[model samples]
Target: MTRVAVVGLGMMGLTHLNVYRSLSNVTIAAICDADADRLSGETTATGNVEGTADASVKSLPAEVRRCSDLNEVIGAADVDVVDICLPTHLHVRFGKQVLLAGQHLIVEKPLARNSTDADELAQAARSAKGLAFVGQCMRFWPGWAWLKDAVNDGRYGKVLAATFRRVVDHPKGAFYENGDLCGGALLDLHIHDTDFVHYLFGMPKSVNSFGYSKNTNEPDHVVTRYLYDHVPLVVAEGGWAMSDGFPFSMSYNLNFENATVDFDINREQSLRICEVGKPIEYPEVDAKMGYDLQLAYFIDCIEKQRKPETVTLENAADTIRIVEAEAESIKTGSAVSLG
Candidate 1:
């Protein structure tokens, strides 16, 4: 069995805890949150399988052992892996600790605040005997998996052009209100879509972007145009409409050489896939929590001694380079070339 410890019990942390409950081979050993009440409440409410359950909301049995300190959970004697749902900047720090403790590490996206930090963490992982994987969950999303398979099978014919949209209401405060972690939509939300674009087709040759920072200049939204070696890509945002004011969906369109693809990601189901021939239900094993698939894959990579499809240091840096270009374009209000 893979004994796991989850740190952070906020939005993403709680979600990770929920997913851990459903895994049979893996057991959630502990959960950490600064708030003792939060941890205890979640522990009792979720039945130790789910986090603090709110009758105000729905309920499920939680499996994680909740705590307040991150290290105490990850450093536990039986911990085989540490799944970090902490703030962005802390990814590298927590990752280093996990690796040093001889436990495999799984971090949520952006890897680190920037390419430089990501590189350093990558080096640490490389030197450590345990495996390290980033939580680029979109890669394992069943809809995307279907799309990639089809493209590789030649259904796309050559992959023409593709566009992505990810937006939500802007956040208030120091941006990294949680910690000195990575903040803003670019690193937080954009990384998923960017990872997709890069996976479907390698890195783009040039990137031009127009960006926006809420009250300050941190980039809450961006519209990026990328020039791929063989195709063109556009990743734009509707601005974060993450408030009660907006009724939204995270959807995208893919224009292939032979067919056009549209994905209507559902509220709680597999993404709807449509093409010229016929529409198909990709039958997503998970809708909201694809992290389970990701976690299992990473574990397979570690226990089986194989590298999973999550981003590598070079790949991560390359993605950030394009992201940086988008940031630049947003700043300059001009198109930036990729090369």
Candidate 2:
């Protein structure tokens, strides 16, 4: 069995813990949280861009060690995998420690606050004895995963044009309010679509972006157009400027030579494929969500002594670069080129 230690008890961290518990060959050996109350099983309902938090607030098993110190969890003899679900800025620090300790690491998305920090973590992972992965879970998400398969297998011919969007009400919390910490909505919220775009089509040649900020200078609302030679129109918009009453939504429309695929979280049947002379068809995806699949895949890789092909440190770093470029474009009012 793969023994896992989840560091953090926030919404994402709790979600990870619950998902790991459901997997057959995995065990939640330890849980660490800076908040003593959370470690003791006190939790307040917190909502994220993913929607209402359904994670149980119950206490952990008696066999599972609860730690308030990160070092304690890291040094424990039974912990094999250290999953870092801390804030964006702390990722590199704790990620490097996990790698150097000879423990397999899985860090939540945005890998690091910036490309420079991401590079540092990548270097550590390269030299570490254990494998490293970033939790860019959208890649494993069922709808997006199906799109990737269709593209790779040429099931949709070639992508002609595509637009992706993610919008949600502004998150009211200390971590999110501080742009320097979370990189605001652009990095925290939008990076999902940005990374998915990079996964679908390689890095764009250039990006032209426009943004608007409310309380902070960081871009809470951004629309970016990616320039690619083959694909004529490729764009993605992400923002958190919606009012508190606005429901979170994520949708995508991809037009291919032979067909078009659409996915909207608001729809009852979220995924559909349309083709000429054929009725619209809804695609059935696995009941397990991205969090479950990502953890399961990482555990399997650890047990098999293989590398994760989907969300590697290298690609995660590249996604940071892309986001940085978008920020630059938003500042300069000109398209930024990517190497």
Candidate 3:
């Protein structure tokens, strides 16, 4: 079995814990959280965008050790993988520690706050004996995964234009409210589409963005246009400025030479392909959420002693670079160029 240690018990961390509990080949060797109440099973279940929350009472299994310190979890010899689900800033610190300890590591998205920190972690992964990856889960999400395959394989001919959007009401907490820690909506919400764009279309030549910052300097609402030579139009908008009652939604429409792919999470049938002179069709997808598949794939990679292809540190760093460029464009009111 692939022994795993998860180092947080917040929404994302709890989501990871529940998924790991369900996988057959993976064992939850240990769980660590600074919140003493949470460690003592006094917290209520938190919901996630993916709808994977467990509303039942929270409790640790008999075999799983509860740890209050990160060092103790990292030093545990039985942990084959250290999944860092902490806040954005702590990723680099704990990520480096996990790698230097010769344990495989998986960190949540944005890799780091900026490309510089991300680059440091990437370099550490290169020199360390263990494998490392960022949890850019959209790459493995079923409908999104299908879209990626279609783009790579040229199933519907080259893409002509693509537009992506993610909008949600502001989260209720200090961690999400602080623009410094969570990077506001740009890093926290829009990075998903930014990373997905990079995964599907590679880095853009330039980025032009317009942002609306209500309470903080960070862009709570922003629209970015990615310039590409072949594809005439590629744009993404992400924000958390919607009213409190506004439901979270993510949708994408890709126009191709021969067909178009459309996906809206809030729709009845979320995924559909419309082709010239053909009926719209909904494709079958694996029922498992991206979180489940990603962790399962990581465990398989550990067992096989191989590197992950989908969410590598290099790709994640590039995504971070794109996001940073977007932020710059919003600040200076000019397009930023990328390598």
Top lDDT model:
2
Worst 10 residues of 2 by lDDT: 48-57
Better of 1 and 3 by TM-score: 3
What ranking of all candidate models by TM-score puts the best one first? 2, 3, 1
lDDT of 3 at 58: 51
List TM-score per model, in order: 0.84, 0.97, 0.96
Model 1: per-residue Cα lDDT over 1-339, one tens digit each? 788777766555666666666667777676677867556653322211122222211132365455677757766887888888777778888889888988888777778888787888888988886788887767786667777787779865776767777655544434343323444677777777777777777777767777666533366666777776677545545345255334334567777766776675544553454556776545554343356677777767876887665656557666776677777777787777766
Query: What digit string (tens of lDDT, one per residue) describes model 2 on residues 222-276?
Result: 9999999988899999999898878889999999999999999878799999986
Q: Where's the lowest-lDDT run of ten residues in candidate 3?
A: 48-57
lDDT tens digits, residues 143-211, model 3? 999999899899899999999999988877788888898898999889999999988888999999999
Give the clash count for each candidate: 23, 0, 0
Candidate 2 off by > 4 Å = 49-53
RMSD to the true structure for each prediction, in A, is 4.5, 1.4, 1.4
Candidate 1, residue 259: CA error in Å? 1.3
Worst 10-residue lDDT window for candidate 1 reads 48-57
Query: What are the Cα lDDT values of the candidates?
Result: 0.66, 0.88, 0.87
